[model samples]
Target: MSSSEQPVGEVQVHPQPAPPGSGPWARFVTWAGQDTIEDYSLRYAPKSFRKWSPMACAITALGGIAYLADYSIGASIAVSHGSASAVVAIIVAAVTIFLTGIPIAYYAAKYNIDMDLLTRGAGFGYFGSTLTSLIYASFCFIFFALEGSIMAQAMKLALHIPLALGYVLGSLIIIPLVLYGMTALAKFQVWTQPLWLVLFVAPIVFIATADPKGFNGFLTWAGDGGTERVTAIGVGAGAGVALSLIAQIGEQVDYLRFMPEKSETPPWRWWSAVLAAGPGWVILGAAKQICGAFLAFYVAGKVGFTAATEPIQQFLGGFGSVLHNDTVALAVATIMVLLSQVKINVTNAYSGSLSWSNFFSRVLHIHPGRVVWLGLHIAIALALMLGNMFAVLNTILGFYSNVAIAWIGAIVADLVINKPLLKLSPSYVEFKRAYLYSINPVGFVSMMVGSFFSILAFYNVFGDFMAAWSPYLALALAFFLSPVICILTKGKYYLVRPNPIREEIEKEPLWAGQTLLDIVDQKRYELPDMVHDCPFHGGTISSLTCTLTKCHDLCKTSAYIDSVTTATLRNAAEPQPTT
Candidate 1:
C-alpha cells in the first residue's frame, strides 16, 4: 500500500482506461463492476436497474423517520414551551426542512448522484466530501442505536425481554434484510408502511376525536412557568433542536438517486412524484411530530405526566385504549416498531456500507466488497447500542445535527444559489473520484467554520439565542459561507475536469432521426463467450435484440460511441454540446 489507498474501483480522477483492449466483460467489470458500492454507487444509477416509482421511494424513505423519538420531541417541546409554543416551533422546523429538501431531492433524482457525489460537485472535493460522509455515517450509527434502544424499550414494555438482547435483536434484524439492498428494502417498506401509519395514527385519532375537550386543554395548556408569556428565547431553544433535523434531507437523497430519468412521461406527474418523495418527506415528518405531541399529551393526561416522554409507552397506551385487547395491542406496537426500524435501518445500513467502502477505498486503496463493510458497519452500530447511546438521544442527535445540517446546508446553497445565479458550479453533477480534487475549500471550509461555531453554541458557549438553536446557526452559516467561498475561490474546485465516460453503449438511444445499426464480427473473436463457457450458472439470459452476452461491440463501428474517449473528449466536450 503506497501513500494512498483508493481501491481499483473505489473511484478516482483520471482512471486509466482498461489496459487497451481487454475482453469487453473484463473491461466493463473492471470499470463499473460495482466496487464495494460506495464508489460504485457514485456513478449513474442505470436505467436497467431502476424499478421503483417515486411514490414508493418517498414512502420508504419516510418509513425510517417513524421513530419513537418524534413523541419524545413533541412531549419535550410541549412541556417546555406549552402546546402553543411547541406548535409554533414544529411549524417553523417543518417548513424550513421542507423548503431546503426540495432542490436537493430534485437534483438527486435528475442527476443520479448520491449525497457524496452531489457534495463533490457542489463544493466538496473527492476527499473533502469524505468528512461529510463521516458526519452522515455518524447519523446512521447514532440513529441505529437510538432506534434499537426504542425497540428494546418496547420489548421490555411488551414482553419483559432484556434490553441487552433486545438491542442485539433490534440491530441484527435489519442485517439479513438489507444484505439484498434496495430490492428487499422496497418490498419490506411497501408491505409494512400502511400498518405503520395506521397503528401510529390510531392512538392520536381515537384520543383526539373521542375527547375534543381534553384535546383543547392540551393545546391551551402551558408548562409550569409558561403562563402569561411567550418567551422568544424559550421558543428559539425548542426550535433549534427541531431544526437539527434539516440534515434528514441526506437520507431522502440516498433513495432519490434511484429515480429514473424523466422522459416522455408527463413532466408534471414525474416531477410531482419525485417532489413528493424527496423533500416532501419533511411535510410528513412535521405532521408526525404534531401527531407525536398529540399522543404524548393524551398519554400524559391518561397515565400521569412523568411517562409523557416515552413514545413506546405513549403509543402503546394510546393503541390499547382503542384496540381493547391486550394481546392485539401488544402485537400492533411490536409490528409498528419492527417495521419502522427495518425500513429506515436497512437504508441506514445500506448507505453506511457504501460510505465506509468509499472512505476506506479512497484512503487505503482497498476494495473489500459491500458485504464486508456491511458487517463492519452493523458492528459499529451494535457497539453503540451496547454502550447505551439510547439514553442520551438528545445530546447525541443535537450535536450530530449541527455537523449534518452544516454539510447539507452548504450543498443546498450551491445547488439552489451558486449554480443558478452566480454560475460558480456546473449544472450537472459528477461523482467520479478521478475527476475531483482531494478537497475543495468552498464546502469543506464552510462546513468546518459553521460546525465549529454551531457546536460551540450548542454547548452554551455562545450565550443567548446562539446557544439554543446552534444547529440552525450552522445551517445559516453554511448557506452563507458556500456561495461566499464559491465567489471568493472563483469556483475552481467544482471539478478537476468534466466526465466524458459512457459505461455501456446500449445506454444511448438510437433516436427517430438517427439511423440505428448493430454489427458483429464473427472471425475476429477475442475470447469465448462466458454464456458459452460458464456451465455452473447456466446462461439464464439471452436476447436476440439486446443479447445479455457480450457481443463484438469492441470491433463494431457502433461500439465506439466516439473514436475519442471521455478523457480525450473532456477538452472537446463543449458544455451542452449541440445535437
Candidate 2:
C-alpha cells in the first residue's frame, strides 16, 4: 500500500468477504436487507445516512403521537375517576413522562442509537436489555392493536364493515408504509401533518364555540356512579392509566436516531428538535386527554357513558355539533380517524420492528432483517384487535403501566443518576455485544424488584390504596434502587472491557473531517469520531461497516490505531488512515 493508504489499525486477521449467493431467493433476501429495511436495526446509526435536518426529524417523531387512543384514555380516566381526579392524574403523568424522556431522548439523538441500544448502555447489559426490548415491543403491538381498533370502529361506522375484517384491513394497510422504514415514514408524516392538525383541532374549536355551556357541565360531571369524587385512590388509578404511555419515548427515539450529528448542526435547531420531538410529545398528549375528557362530557348525555369513551363516538359527536348534516359529520369523523390511525400505527409498526429485531438477533442468533419482524409485529397486533383488546382497554393499560414504568424508571435512574450524578456508569453508550456482560445486576435487578412489588400492589396484594398507586410505586422503587444497586455492586458489570475509542476521543478529539479506509470494501470514507473494534479479527473498522457487514460481535474496542498510522497522522496535517 502507498503512504496515503496506510492502515490505521493493525490486526491479526482482516475481515473476510460475506459468502455470495446468486439465486432468486438470495436476490430477494438481499433486496430485503437494503438500508431501508435494515435501518441499522441491531446497531448504531452512522452519520453518513442521518442527512435529514433537525426540523424534519422532529416533525416525523411528533407524527407518531397523533393516535386517538389519547382521547379514549382521557375519557376512560375521567369517567372512572371523575374530571377533577382525571385532571390531576393527567398532569402528573405528563410531567413525569416529560422529565424521564429528556435524558433518554438526548442520549439517543447524541449517540445516534435507538431506545434499545440506549437501554443496553444506560444500565442494562447486552442481554439485560433484551427484556426491555420485549417490554417495548409489547407496548408497540398493544398500542398498534388499540389504534387499529379505533380505525376499525371508524370503518364499521362508515362502510358497515364487520370489526373482524376491519381489524385485518387496518393491520395490513400499515405494512407497506412501514416496510420502507424512515425513508417513507418521514415524507408521509410531513405530508399528512397539516391536514391531521386541522382535523384534530376542528372538533375542539367547534365544541367551544357552539356549546359554550358544555364546559360548565363538564366541570361538575360526576363519574359512573354520579357520586364519584376526587380522592387519593381515584387520582392514583387515573394516573396509572395515563402513565402507561411512558414507553412511548422508545417510539420517539426510533425516529430521533436519524438526527444529524449535533456538532454539524446548529445548537438551537438541534436542541429544539430533540426536546420538541422527545418529551414535548406529552404537551399535546395531555391536551388531547383534557379534550377527550371534555368531549366525553359533551356527548355523554346523548351517547351514554360507554359510547362516550370511544374516540370514534367522541369525534362523531364533536363533528355533529359543527356540521348539522349527520352524514357529513360521520364522513369527516371517519376520515379523521383513518388518517390519525395510519400516522400512528406506521410508527408503532416501525418501532416494534426495531425492538423485535434487537430482541431476536440476540436471543435467536439469527438475522432475518427488520422487514420480516415488521410482518410478525403486525400479525401479533392483528390477533389482539380480532381478540377485542379494546373492550378492556382500561384494565389492560392499568395492569401494563406497572411493568412499563418500572422498566423506564430503571433506565432514567441509570441515565440521570448513575451516569451523570453518581458517576458509576460509563459516560458514553456502549451497545455493541462483545463489550457487555450477559446481564448487569444494577438495572436488571432494580427493574425486576420494582416490577415485582408494583405488580403485587396492582393486584391488591397490599390494599385498595396500594392497588391504585402501583405505577408510582414502580417508578419510585426502580428510580431509587438503581443508584443503590450500582453503589453496592461498584458498577463493575457495566462493561466487560474499557472502550479505547471513547477514551481516545475524551483525551483528544478526532478532526471532524478525518477519513479512514475500510479494507473490506477497499474504499475510503469519512471516519466517525468513534469506531468499533472487530473482536474476531482484532482490526479497527468504521462503525458504518460494523452494521453494513452484519458482523454482529464487533466489540467497539477503541480508537483506530496502528503505530505507523498514529505517528503519521500526528506528524502530517492531512494524513490518510485505513482500517
Q: Model 2's lDDT to the true fold? A: 0.84
| lDDT by residue (tens digit), candidate 2, 1-579 | 543564342111112223577764454366444666677777667666776999999999999999999999999989988888888889999999999999999999988889988998888898899999999999999999999999999999899999999999999999889888889999999999999999999998998888766678575577685334577888899999999999999999999998987777899999999999999999999999999988898888899999899898999999888798999999999999999999999999999999998887777665556777888899999999988998899999999999999999999999988988888899878876656777998999889999999999999999999999999999999999999999998899998766665655445434323455555544444433234456554556554344344454534324433443475667897756888
lDDT of 1 at 573: 73
Candidate 1: residue 362 Cα off by (Å): 1.6
List CA RMSD, all candidates: 10.2, 5.8
> What TM-score goes with each of the models?
0.79, 0.89
Instruction: List clash counts for every candidate, in order.
Output: 8, 4
> Please, what are the lDDT tens digits per residue for candidate 1 over residues 1-579?
331442221221112235456665344335343422323343445444566776777666766566666666666677666777777778887877888888888888776667766777778886798788787777777766766777887888888899889888887778787766667667777787777778767777766665555466667767544532455666666666577567677777777776755664468866887777777877777777776666667677666654666677676767776677878877787777766666677877878876775665556554435666777888898899889875565566667778888888888898898889898887666555444566889889999999999989988897877776787888899999999999998988876543333122224422211211112211111010001111222221111111222332232232242433544678767687579
Per-candidate Cα lDDT values, in order, are 0.66, 0.84
Off by over 4 Å in 1: 1-42, 222-229, 301-306, 324-327, 500-579
Clash pairs, candidate 1, are 5-364, 5-365, 6-365, 7-365, 12-433, 12-434, 13-433, 13-434
For residue 542, what is the lDDT in candidate 2? 50
